[model samples]
Each structure stands twice: as structure tokens, then as C-alpha cells.
Target: MIELAVIALRGVQYALISLTFGLPAFVLLNRPHLDERALQGLRAQVGWATGAMVVVVPIAILAQTALMAGSWSGALDPQALLVVVTGMGLGVALALRWVAALAEGLLFAFRLKGRGFWFPAVLLGLVSVVTLAWTGHGAATECVGKFIHQGSTAVHAAAAAFWIGALAAFLWLAFRPIEPGSEEEARAAAMLTGFAGSGTVAVAILVATGLVNTAFLVGPSRVLQLPQSLYGGLLILKLGLFVLMLALAALHRFQLAPQMAARSAHALTHLRRSLLVEFVCGGLILALVALLGTLSPPMAM
Candidate 1:
């Protein structure tokens, strides 16, 4: 169905945009912690993500157009598509998102991070990520609470992207950490360990903002009835996956990271497995997020 296509495209859009934002932001925050090789590797990932955004953004726009027009054929209708792209607030947001994504691609192609282009690239990526809030409940709240809901959604998304995107970077690094048992390996392990503080901060922000967003969507009174509603059920599933990710993150912080720091046998091996599983969970979360956006909350009903 056209609806399913929109959700699927939106998931891919979110995943790509989040990586385009998250990877560079993560490296910038942990620049000193990562050496040139690790930085180079992650930067390559950023470029790839940005490039994909250039293609994916437009496709997502068209899909939204189809949803708005109420048919697949309507997605290609010039007039209807134009209205969605040029007349509506969704259009404005998508235009900005696409432009920001394109700017990132151009910057990366011209050599990001070295020629004074990295900052602009980061800003563009942030724009692309935050603009996504406009398409969902983030920007749909009524007066008096509109800004609060939007802010919560934006911060929730950014924080989630940062955490999830960094995990992807870590997975890439885990698979090819330059060399094993060398200084590179130790520094890499240290980088992973160093993420504890910032990662915790990101998680804390996610929880707080998530609570705020949930209250606005589901209302506290509807909490007990959540299981009986489609939106609520999906939210519970998303929360379950989130908790699993948290549990894995905790294990990495308290157990595996220490073991890696001490050079225990196969510590890195254990880490690679955990990172893969965690990142997979993150991907599933994004998919659920896409689906959730299409369903009305119990409060709305």
C-alpha cells in the first residue's frame, strides 16, 4: 500500500539523516580521543551517509507527496507534488532538509574536515535532522504546548541519533580497528571507554524528552489502556527494544569496556558482537519510529 511505502521510505530517510548527522558530530565531540585513522574511517562513513541523503531525501519527499495526494500515481502529478513541495509547511521542511543534505554532499566531495567546510557540514546535518520534526507530532501540537512538544521531539531525535549513529561508527571501528594489540587498538578501546560520559548524557536526554513527548501523545491518564491501542502497543515494543539497547550499553560500560581496557582475551571480539546486536536494535527502533508516526495516539482517539 501507499501508506506502507511512506513508512518504509521514512525509515530509510531517518536512518540516513541520523547517520549523516551523528557520525560527524560524534567524531567532532571525540576528536582528540580518536586518532587520524579512526577519524578518517568514520569520516568516510559520514560522506557515504551524506551522499545517500542526496538521493534519499527527494525520494522521501515524493513518497510524502504520494501520501498527501492519496495515490501512487498522484505522487508523480506535477501540480499536487508542487503544492506539497512548495506550498505546505511540510514542503518547506523537506526543501530545507534536501538542501542541507545536498550541501553536506557537496562539502564532503570537496574534502570535508580539512578545508574549513566541516563546521558548515555539521550545521547542515543538524538542520537536516531537526527539520524532520516538522513531519510528525513534534510540530503538530496545539497552542500553548506547541513549542514544548516540538522541542522535546527535536531533542529526542537528535539525542537518539547521536547515540545510535555513534554505535554504527563504533561497529565500523570494531570490525577494522586498524591493528590488534597495538597503540591504535588501545586508543580505540580508550575512545570506546571515553564515550561513557557523553553516552550517558545522550541517554538521559532521550529518556527525559521521550517522557515529555509521550505525555503529550498518550496522556498520563491513558497509560493503563496503552496495551489496548495500536499506538500504545507499538510504543511498548519500541520501549522494550530501547531497554535492550540500554542493557547492552550498560554491559559495554561496566563489563566489556573494562575487560577491553585490561586487554583480556577476546575482549574486542565480545565487543564487536555486542556492537552489531546493539546497532541492529537501533535500526529496528528507527523502523518502529517510522511506523509509529503513521498511527494516531490513544489520546487522539
Candidate 2:
């Protein structure tokens, strides 16, 4: 029960942090040529997410400390706190998260626009996601293996944030009433088309990195026996959800995206629903990852 609570908290923290960086990063890269209203809406979305991360990061740190110490009281003990903060990889990752959270807070408070804000926010957000690699299975390895695993994991995580987080921002944009044949509608179509192209590339990266990470973590011999272990079972579930998300994404890219260019309401509605489903699947995958991080893989055992 305690572990479950920790996993749930970690899952939420991970998701929120991903969004905190992902949203701003998307705006920086895509810059979809949106109108004043759409641009303001996107900015507001990012601001709110960043502000929320400022709160969530501290709570996640406390929860992680307690989890590592084996009890809430122990988490507060100076010796336990010292060991966790100084000795553990997760501790370092948490510290990095704090730095990212502070940067995010500054971005939210000042609301800096133009290149000034974009450059710093993008850098901070990328660092936040990349630093998270230290908290996972990759950090447990040795020597050259450690570097390879961590690098791949970091790329995998960044790609996921780009795809899933952007989907969430796009869904929010879709909710606004877009009149048929208006400039706003055309911009929306263009943005959707642009995202679809980028999303395909991101998904390809995700698959390649996923394969690499899986090779490092689990060998071919353990493939058939995965369902017998808790970690492997959860991994299988995550993979299944990932496949479903890919199918939805394909539908969006091939069918819905083209129709959106024509300002088809049906396509827009279906795409919105698909994005929501994909976002939920991404959340579930993160939760499984949180649990998996706390367990020993079958191959390792």
C-alpha cells in the first residue's frame, strides 16, 4: 500500500513535470503562426502548467524521501535525509527537478515573451527531462553501459514529452469553437498538419529508443517469460497501450489530418477524442513506469 501510494504520487509528479516543459518546448518549436487569441491561449496554458509544477515538485520530493527512507518519520530524520539527498541517484534527479521548477516559476511570474523567454525556458525544460534519466534503470548500470542507457532513455523521454504533451495542448486548442473557413480554422489546420508531421518523427524516435532500452534491460531469452513477473507484466501492458496510441496517431495522421484541412467538423471532433485517449494512455504508461522503476526486472532477478 505504501509503495502504491508512492508510485501514484510519482506518476502525477512525472506527468506534471513533463507537461511543464513539454508545452513551452512545443510553442518554441512549432510556433504555429497562430492569431493573437490562440497565441495568448497557448501562453496561458503553459503558464498555468509551469505554476502547477512549482507546487508539485516539492511534494514529489517529500514523497520520494519518505519512500526511500521506508517511513514518513524516517524521511525527516537528518541521517536518512542526508543519505538520500547525497548518495542516491534519485536524490540528484530531484535536485535537478527543483532547479527546473524554480526556472519555471520565474517564467510564470515574469511572463517573458519573444526570444528572451523562449530560449531560457526551452533550455530549462529540456534539462529537466534529460535529468530525469538519472532516476531510472539506466542510472543503475556501470561504465559505458550507464552512459549509453542514460542517453537513450533521455532521448526517449524527450520524444515522449514532445508527442504526448503537444497532443494535450492541441486538444485544448480544439475545444475552442472554430468557425468554418475563417483564418483561425486555417491556422488550426496548418498547426494540426505540422504536428502530425513532427509527431511521426517523434514516434519513430520513441520506437527506436524503446527498442534500445528494452535490449539493455531485458534480453531475448526473457521475452516469453515476461508475463510471469510483476515488472515484465506491467511492461507488457505499457507496450500494449503504446501500440494502441500509435494506431490512434496513425488514424489522425492519415485520415483526420487531411480532412481537417477541409475544415471538416467530424474530423476535428474525432481527432480531439483520439488525442484525449492518447493522453490518457500516456498517463497510464507513466504510472506503469513509476511502478517498474521501484521493482527489479525479471532479467535482473
Candidate 3:
């Protein structure tokens, strides 16, 4: 049970790292502050996220092994090690892609000011996809089967990023307070709304593609029987979290967002409160994801 929890925590824990790293990245990208101080701050933010990924994954693997065994020695085989490394590597790549996207968005925002821009976001996105494919190929298949599985996993991963990743960003912005009655506040809100719309579209794609990938990864019969197994229980937990995220998203989109757009102080307050709640739930959901990753599949049981 402890091992399961640890496994589940791994992904969720690291997911937070990306969010922590990304929120500021978004801010830096969307509204470029040319000041040396701002640049230094952004660099530090990126560094912290990168540092965490470098330091934490190995510890997580060791901790997981130790949880399963009395000691970490000989607890994991080469294949398991490969899987862990690949998973973490993919995560790092994905995080970079998100950062890059934020950069690209910033570039577009810059274009409004007559600056010629390059495709940093598009380039980083492609890199992210490539890394994901490289990591997934090991699990999906070794040859042509590798490409098929890689493509499927990439689709699934992108969906996950759209929904889960974006949720993390929204939560961050929500929890952090914006100054009252300021021009920067309005600009911030506009920037946030643009991304919010992007997130919405991403979520839609994620859901549609996630369903397809789920079908391929786990047969319908196994999926149906998932509730009976440990994996199933964790997956159910993840699903519940996902549903909660959806509900919160709706509130943000239909309810609070309009109020905020109108600059209604009351609506802004409500949006902040709701965002805080969603952040907490998102954190919990991430922990469950980490546990789910560690469990054996329902079919395996």
C-alpha cells in the first residue's frame, strides 16, 4: 500500500514542479519585462524547476525501491530503471515544451508592439513531442510497433498536458493575488484570459484523444474490470479528480471569468476563492496519479 502511494506520488509530485516553474514562465513570456531584475528572476525560476527535476527523480526511484524492499539494493532491474529514467526524461522534456509555449505566446504578444518573432513555441513543442516519442517507444514497441505506440502515447500525453498542466497554471494565477486598481492588473487579466481559452481548447482535445488512447492502452474489458483491482481504484480516484477539475473549469469559464472580465470586484474575489479550491484539489489529484503509475495494470492482476 505504501509502495503504491509512493509510486502514485512520483508523477504528481513532479507535475507540481512543472507548474511551479511554469507560472512565472508564463508571466515572463506574456509580458516581457526587459529589466535585468525580471530577466534574472525568470532565469532563476527556470533554474529551480530544472534543478528539482534533476535532483528529485533519482531520489524518487530509490525511495520507491526502498519502500518495496527493505533496502534499495537490487530492488530494481535494468528494465525498471529504464522505465523510470524514460518517464522522468519525458517529463523534463514536456516541461521544457510548456515553457517554450509560454515563450512563443510572449513573442506573439510582442508582435503587437511591432517586433519580428520566431517560432520558439512551435520548435519547443516539436522537441517535446519528439522526446515523448523517444521515451514511449520503449514501452509501446521496439520496431514499427514503436511508432504506433509512440504516436498514441504522444496524443495521450498532450491531452494530459492540456488538461492537467493548464489546470496547474490557472490555479497558480488564481492563488497569487493581483494588485487592485492597476493598469498591470488589466493587462494581466487579458493575458490570463487568452491562455484560458487556449487551455479550454487543449482540454477538449485532451479529452477526445485521451478516450481513444485509453481504449488502445487498456482493452474495453480490462477497463470495465478496473474497478476491482488496485490499479482500477487509483484510476477511479484520478477520474474523480479529473471530473472535479472539469467542474472548476466550467465555473471559471462560465461564471467567474465574465465577472472578472467586467472588472467586478466581487467576481474577481469569487474567482480567486474558486481558483484556490481548485489548486488544492489539483494537488491531491496529482498525488493520486503518482500512485496509479506505480500499480500493476488491472489486466495484469
- Candidates' lDDT values, in order? 0.83, 0.78, 0.53
lDDT string for model 1 (14-48, tens) is 89877887887777777777777777778778888
Q: Model 2, 1-301: lDDT tens per residue?
A: 5577767767876786667667777777667566668767877776776777677766666677788777777667777776776788787777777778788678657868766776677677788788779988899878898899999999998988777677777777777887655666666667766777678889899999998888888877788888998888999999999999989877776787778778776776787788888888988998888888889876578
lDDT order of candidates, best first?
1, 2, 3
lDDT: which candidate is best? Answer: 1
Candidate numbers sorted by TM-score from highest down: 1, 2, 3
Residue 47, model 3, lDDT: 42
Instruction: Give TM per candidate.
Output: 0.95, 0.93, 0.66
Better-scoring candidate (lDDT), 1 or 3:
1
TM-score between model 2 and native:
0.93
Clashing residue pairs found in predicted model 2: none
Residue 92, model 3, lDDT: 50
lDDT of 3 by residue, 53-92 (tens): 4455455555554554555564466555554445565445
